[model samples]
Target chain A: MNHRRKVTVGGVIKYIVLVLVFIFLAGPLIWEISLAFKGPGDNVYAIPQYLIPKTPTVNNFVEAFHRVPMAHYFANTLVVVAINVLGNIIGCSMAGYAFGCLKFRGRGFAHGLFALAMLMPTEGLLVSTFLLVKSMGLTNTLFGVALPGMVGPLNVLLMTNAFAAVPKELIEAGKVDGANKWQRFVHICLPQVKGTITVVGILAFVASYNDFLWPLVALSDDSKYTLTLGLNRLQGTFYTDPRLVAAGACISLIPIIVFFAIFQRYLFEGLQAGGIKG
Target chain B: MARSVTQPQGRGDARNAPSARRHHRAIDDDGPSSWLFTIPAFFILLLFVFYPFLNTIRLSFTNSRMLIPGHWVGMENYVKLFQSDQFWTALLNSSLYVVCVVPFMLILPLILASLVAKGPKIIGFFRTTYYFPVVLSAVVIGLIWTNLLDSRGLINSIFQSLHWITTPIPFLTDRWLTLFSAMLVTIWEGLGYYMIIYLSALANIDPSLYEAAEIDGAGPIRQFFAITVPGVRSTMTLILFLSSASAFRVFSEVYVLTRGSGGVGGEDITMTMLIQREGTGLSARTGYASAISVVLLIIVGAITVIQQLIVRRGDD
Candidate 1:
């Protein structure tokens, strides 16, 4: 009976600690959400700090959209994200297929090139990349922002691993039936690794969506600003009003949250794969 | 199905075929088309990654600006960089960031992972919630924390009401406090990411070892040290390297937190910020920035080499 009591106490303590951690991790987000819904009459600086707004309103969202071109920026971000996702998926899968299944001369050397590119410190290369983009006359364009990261080397390696895991017997069967390499790749290998393809697609989407630094550097034109840049502008313009800034943050953040919630399983899988290898 | 018939045939072929013949077959099977498959990715890597890297090194030796390609200046840029006080401050700030942030990142995430690793169904919910911050961009995280850490923000108000302090803490305004505040945000944003990595590593540890320890009446803490730490030692080292490297290169958090000023007198600037500041815009000192970029590269490379040495030693 005493042992049972001790176990119960331990369980209770574990739960208490878990709850505190949850509050620590997720509490700020909740507060931000609360602040977004707050009406003008609500004292944002209330001493006791009420998380629940006394008066709720959508005015802040309206004001945020009004003050900044939020909708235009959102559309701009989507276009960039589309280019990034398509580019990474098509480019990475093709490269990955070659590295994983093909046995040609200099294959190891070619693969090492990708590994070298993967390990290159992007932060250190920002200036030169910008210069390269400018020399190509792509600066201030969304394409410039999307160009450098379109084919991530890590994604190529991930897709390579995925394609390699396709059953060898299946490939042999395709060969025996007189299907060429392309046909076997498309009809046999590609379908089998749909899970990994989805993982790749989701990773590319999140990365392009969340990318801030490159876009900040590449885009000098206000009309071409992605959502992150737009929000930064909003923060600068509306520093006095906490509510509008909170609402702007929510606007940019909600879509990602929804997307993450839906595809978190695959995201986690991709993250683990990338994390381990990287 | 035809697959069943071909499976044995494939096995027989594999058995009958010598390894040399298989290699020749594979080469013939791929042909030049395999090279075609790799072209697009390689093009991007060469054009964007490798060329720029080589160009940065060359540009570091020249006095290039944003538009005009200026003449070579020998080692003048490096000489000036060594003399610059701003350079030292930025370097010190970045190093301080790595020092302050890595330990907490190493310890906290492992504890979080272990807590969630084995528990009821609800623990899965906790794991997901913890990862919410990871998905949010650094901009959103910066905005969220800036609001919370503001003088009239939620935290200060709570502290004041509770009589914890007489003055609202200058989390965003004061120089050192601002850097530390940014570090806090870094830790908050990174907790979930590193936690996931640790969780994956923990899953690979042998369950039988834990059961054996439990039978021997070893408590959780003792078992964690004796079994869990050693099991995840390599992972811990990995996290240490990852967290420190990222901390050194931190940009967005400090940038957003300071609203692009890099704190008063730009005291809180990092290496990336310094590079961006010098290398961008019209009249930009691209040559000087390239020199700093080379410095950044050398330091990160040093970290990686040292980490490899440590990992090799640990293996021995």
Candidate 2:
């Protein structure tokens, strides 16, 4: 009976700690959500710090949209994300298949090139990359924002590992049936690595959606600003009011949350299979 | 193809036998076509990644402006960089960021991971909720924390209501306080990410070892110190390197908190911010910024090399 009490006590303590952590981690988000819905009549700086707005409304959201071209920014971000996802899917998968399955000369050299590219800090190369994009006449363009990150070395490697794990028997069987290389790759190898493909797609989407630094450097025009940049502008403009800023932030965050909720399982799996393992 | 059909071999011996070799040669004769597959990716990498890197090095020597391609200045930019007060302050702030932020990142996440590693069905829910911050853009995170740490914000308001102090803490106004506040944001944003990495590492540790420790009357704390610490040591090292490197290159948190001013009088600037400030805009000193970029590269590269040496030493 004493031991049972001790176990229960331990479990209770564990839960207490967990709850504290939850409050710390998710508190700001909840506060932001509350703040976004707060009407002008609500005292945002209340002494007790209410987690729910007394007079809940969508005025802040509407105000945020008016202050910035929120829908235009969203549409621009969507285009950039689509280009990135499609580019990474086609580009990385092909490169990955070549590296993983094909026995070709200078393969080691090609792989080394990718490894070197992976290690080059994007922060360090911001200037010259901007110059390159400018020289290509793609400055202030969505394509320029999407171009540099479209085929990341990490994704290539992730897809390579996935392709390498495709059973040899399957490939051999396809070869026996006189299927060409592309035929075998598409029919045999690609189907086996659907999970990795989804993971790659999700990763590409998140990276592109959340990207701010490169876009800041690439596009100088306000009309071409992505959601992150637009929200930053909103914050800069509306420094006095937290409500509109919160609403702007929420606008940028909701899609990511929805996307994450749908595909979070694959994300964790991808982290295990690709990130740490590599 | 005929040879593969006639002399079927096991997967293991296929690499060794001459017949299997012949079969592989016939089936895997995709030399030129394979090169075709890799072309598109390499083209992008070369154009965007490789060329720009080479160009940055070359541009550092020239007195290049944003529009006009200037003549070679021969280390003038580097000389100017070393003499600048802004460079020194930025370097100091970035170094201080790594020092203050990395320790919390290493420990907090490990503890968080252990707490959620084993539990009831609700643990999964906790894990998912915790990762919410990681998925949010850094801009959003910066906005969230900036409001919370504002002078009349939720935290200060709560403290004042409780009579903790008369005046609100200058979380984003004071120079050093602002730097530390940004570091706090970094840690808060990173906790879930590193926790996920730790969870994976924790999963790899042998369960039998824990059972053995339990049988020997070792308590949870004892087992953690003896088994768990050693088990996740490599992961700790990885987190150490990752956190430190990221801390050194921190931009968005400080950038957003200071509203792109890099604190009052630009006292809390970072290396990347310095690069951005100099290298961008119509009147950008591209040459000088390239020089800063080169310095940034060297420091980050040194960190990586030092980390490798430490890992090798630990292995030895």
Candidate 3:
């Protein structure tokens, strides 16, 4: 009875610690939300910080939207994300089919290349990639920003792992029924890896949406600016007032926040499925 | 675009005949058509990734400006990079950042995962909140933290209200404090990401092991170190490699917080920032940038290879 009581006490303590950890993680964003809602006259330096504002207002968000072309930036970012996500899904799925499902020569070499590509710090490739984009007359264009990330090595690897998990007999059955390799992939293998494809697609979606440095460097036009670049510019413009900048940050963050909330299960499930085992 | 081009052909094939093509396969699946599956990715990778990689290496030998080409300087770019004090400072700061950040990123998540390993379904909601920052852009995190770190910001206000300190802490300004402050931010951001990895790992462990351990009168801590840690050993290595690699490439945090310096005194400068500065600064030397990049690639690549070797060897 005493030992069981000790176990119960320890469980309570552990639960308390876990709750504190959650507080530490969620505190800043909660603070940011309060800051965003503070009106121009509210005391930001309140002696006792409050998670909720004294008099909440949407003026900061209005100012954030007014300070920059939030709509334009959102549309531009969506375009880049759409193109990159589409490219990663199609190109990576195809590459994955070849590497995972087909018994082709040079497959080992190809897989090795993908692994190496996955590890190389992309910051190292920035200068040359920028130069190449420039030389191709693609500067100030969204496509230039999207092109380099289109077929991500990591996504390709994840898709390969996903496709490999599909029963081999399915593809062989399609092949025996006169389906060519392409048909076998399109009709048979693709459906099996749909969940995984969604997993990789969502991963790519988050990345492209949040990408900053490449878009900042590759595209010089305001019209081409992504949400990060636009929000940063707004922060620069509203240097003295953090409340307005917080609003901009909230704007840029909401979509992915919504996305993760909806598909949080997929992210957890994908890891268990070994989508990133490579 | 890839779908548009490939889908129509598949439809065309389907319309032609269903039974005629059966059993008439080209003797083997390893026909010339295999290239059709791999070629699109191959082309993009060759055109963008490989071609520029070669260009970067070639440019390292020559004093190539962004727009103008110069004569090959042999090993001068590498020589200058090795001797630069700036390079040493960056190397020290980056190394310090890695030393501080990677361990926290690895272990804390395991603890949290174990803490909430089999709790009620609401753990998902808490898990989402923990992982929230991972999805947020680095720039936004930078901004949020910057607000909190300001002289009269929330942190200072709280500190003073609690009588912890009379003056506001120079969280983002002091030379010595900047990297540590950045490390704190990193720890916060990484907790959720690595937690998910560890949680998934923890889920896969046999519940029977814990039940058996309980039968032996083992406590939770002993059970963790004895079984849980060992069960997820490979995951620990994976997170270590990932966090270490990212630490070596740290940029957006420092860039946003200091508006491009470690602090007011320019105490922090990462290798990535150095490459950007050299590549695009008024000095405008692609050769130097390439050399720095090559060094970073070598260091990061070597670590990557070593980690993979360990992981692969374990598999063998």
DockQ of each: 0.49, 0.48, 0.39
Residue pairs in collision within model 1: none
Ranking by lDDT: 1, 2, 3
A1-278 per-residue lDDT for model 2 (tens digits): 23433456767887898899999999999889999999988998788688878899999999989988999999999999999999999999999888767877666567668766765678889999998899999999999999998898777767766676677889999999999889988998888777778877887887888888899999989999999899889889445799999999988888988888898987775554323212
The superposed Cα distance between candidate 2 and the true structure at residue A221, in angstroms, equals: 1.1
DockQ versus reference, model 2 = 0.48
Stretches of candidate 1 exceeding 4 Å from the true structure: A1-6, A275-278, B1-29, B309-316
Worst 10 residues of 1 chain B by lDDT: B1-10
By DockQ, the best candidate is 1
Off by over 4 Å in 2: A1-6, A273-278, B1-28, B309-316
Stretches > 4 Å off in candidate 3: A1-7, A270-278, B1-28, B281-283
TM-score of chain A for each candidate?
0.95, 0.94, 0.92
Candidates ranked by TM-score: 1, 2, 3
The DockQ for candidate 3, computed on C-alphas, is: 0.39
Tens digits of per-residue lDDT for model 2 on B183-281? 989888888888887888898899999999999999777988899889999888877887787889899999999989999999999999999999999
Candidate 3 lDDT, B1-316, residue by residue in tens? 1111111111112212222333433244465567687777777787777877787888889888887877799999988888988888888888888899998988898988887677667775676677667777788888899899888888999999999999899988887677787788878877777787787678779999999999999998999999999999978987888789888888878778877655665668888888777776334788778888888888888878788788768766
Per-residue lDDT of model 1, residues A140-202, tens digit only: 998888999899877777777667667788889999999988888789877777776777788
